[model samples]
Target: MEQFIQDWGYIALFLYSFGGGFLALAIAGAFSYAGDLNIYITVIVAGVSNFIGSQFLFYFAKYNKSYMDETVNKHRRKVAMVKTMLKKYGSFMIFIQKYIYGVKTLVPLVMGISAYNPFKYTVLNAIASAIWAIVIGYISFTAGKLLLSFADDFKYVGFFTVLLVLGILVYSFKDKKKVKKQ
Candidate 1:
């Protein structure tokens, strides 16, 4: 991963930040903490990448308004609720949408379809992106620092966590198989 980051530089980080969401951003933060990259630059690149990605989605939905509406109509209630929120909140909605788990992409697309002003959306999104990037990156960097301090102790904890995850996966898979057979 370090080699890849070295080779690709900020472009790789941009792509990762654009699509990778929380996990990818956290990993990039960890890399920055390790001196493989610059935290400030990472934050900027992530913010810009996220802004561009959202803009692209917005434009796509804007141009294909009919299709977008048709697709969203399947969830009419949810769409209406989101539209109400966007109307009532506007800038605040755009600003905090990045932190909202499922609506990160949907909100921007909905705003576009709703014909919200492009300039305002861009400004608000840029601000939100910067804040989100900085906050998440800092948290991840701090986490990396703490992890390094307790590396030896964390090995046992990591092993247990992995085992627990695997156990859950196995149980879920078995449950699914049983349901299918029935």
Candidate 2:
């Protein structure tokens, strides 16, 4: 991973595309700190990458609404429940939905089809993206620091293991809620 980071310098394409969310954030954060904050290149990179990925998903949902509706119709009760929740909660659903594995991709698109306002969409998504970037970036940055401090020791392995576990747990909970909604 270090070699990969070294090779690309500030670009974390591989990590953003393939790494688990937490790992990507942690690495971005660590790199930002390691570079001494001369500029927020790492943060901006991670933020932009994440925002682009998320917006792609959102656009997919927007474009594929009919298809998704057909798929969701296979379970009408679930769709009805989601619609009710979305109606009752308004824009907060977008923020809450990001915790789920793929719902981040879905909510914005789905909301676009609903009564949600575009201005609300812009505000909610931007805020959510910023928070997500900061949280992930900080974790990655701190992970890098820990690895540096204990370079010769085996604790770095444990640190990463903990990160992996936490990520899995968070994803799992999100998935579980999605299943329940379905």
TM-score versus the correct structure, for each prediction: 0.75, 0.59
Query: Which candidate number maximizes lDDT?
Result: 1
| Residue-level lDDT tens digits of model 2 in 1-182 | 55666567455543463222445556556665666331256666655666666566556666777876776677566556667768887778776765566455456556655656666677677777667666666666767777556654867788999999999999999999999999
Top candidate when judged by TM-score against the true structure:
1
Model 2 TM-score (2 dp): 0.59
lDDT of each: 0.80, 0.62
Q: Which stretches of candidate 2 lie over 4 Å from their true place?
A: 1-3, 9-22, 34-39, 73-85, 147-152, 155-182
Q: RMSD in angstroms, all models?
A: 4.2, 10.9
Cα lDDT of candidate 2 equals: 0.62
Clashes of 1: 0
